[model samples]
Target: MKHRDSKDEEKVYKINGSTSSMGNNRKKKKNMQRLGGTGLSLEAFANAKSMSNKYNPAFKKKQREFYKNAKYVSKYKQSLKQQSQQIDAFSAVRPIEDQNRTRDVDEKNIKNKNKKKPSMEELYKKKREEEEQARIEREASIQAKKVGREKAEAERKATRAKMFKKTKYGQPVMKYRIEHLLQTIQSSSRISVNNSN
Candidate 1:
């Protein structure tokens, strides 16, 4: 047979056994079967315990009262109030003594502190070095991109040549087209410098 008939195969079947639940919902099947035929309801069976094994619940009343008094809350509040008052009294006065310098003297002092500066020659050399490094990196990236493109083009041409080789068609037009494409690709792939004598 060339191929099997698709209609003879069975269709795929999917059964979802998972449940959308918060926790396990397993039920005791044996107990269910035993109680199912009896006349008692499930709720009656749950609440129907013997009197010999029962005891009183812990708390029967809903409302409750605490009897302990805490003394530390008022003490802490008073201490925090006194500390805030002390901080306010000290913040009005400056902590350090200021120097009595005139406006012109202050300006001269500022200028002296900022006197040191880089030379023009050093700045120029740093700028030139940065530019040279950037140019070198740019050239390297361009060369890498050119190499990648060349590799990809070569692989494409090889695959096309292989595909045409396997075909046995003898039409003259198709043969010429294929040969021309392959030859043009090969010529382009060659690196020929025009500066030769």
Candidate 2:
């Protein structure tokens, strides 16, 4: 390789020169002093603020109670405002025809309320009737379920008896096995005949 020229060498050195000592020429910064009017040291001032009577327990308790009461009052007022708004909206949506109908219904309700109350015997009879009707429906549902269960049990019994039947020689019955064998033989014969054709 050819040696670098002096001008080129100087240019390379300037580009790659170390800048580690560049900051050393800057003046050292001095810490700022805190101005104090209270004749106390730094630690003492900090501790004094923490122990100040302005934040005593009694004052904090009173502030907490005041805030709690204010929160409850605001919540109650908001609820009342919402209820009034809902009532206003409901009344506004009622048409004149509905208002008349509602008035008639209200009059009927008032008249019913003014009428003589049912005697105790009549009330008891109505209650008994309702209870008897409920009991009848419940009994009907239970009977239906019982009948369904009996039907399922009979079917299961029939299937099990068919599958587990035994001959006089104490050998298990093989009627289903013979039928399966016959079907398989017929299928094989049909396949063979088709292949021959």
Top candidate when judged by lDDT against the true structure: 2
Clashes of each: 0, 0
lDDT of 2 at 92: 84
- The worst-scoring run of ten residues by lDDT in candidate 1 lies at 60-69
Identify the candidate with maximal TM-score.
2
Query: What's the C-alpha lDDT at position 34 in model 2?
Result: 34
Q: Alpha-carbon error at 60 in model 1, in Å?
A: 99
lDDT of 2 by residue, 1-197 (tens): 98898677656765888322332333222111233233678997788679888557678899999999999999999999999999889988989898899899999999999999999999999999999999999999999999999999997788668767889999988995576578779999999999999
Native-referenced Cα lDDT, model 1: 0.62
lDDT of 1 by residue, 1-197 (tens): 56645333222111244432221323444556677844557776566533324532333121221111234666778899999999777754534332333456789989998998789999999999999999999999999999999999998897666555634465344664677788888776663433342
lDDT of each: 0.62, 0.81
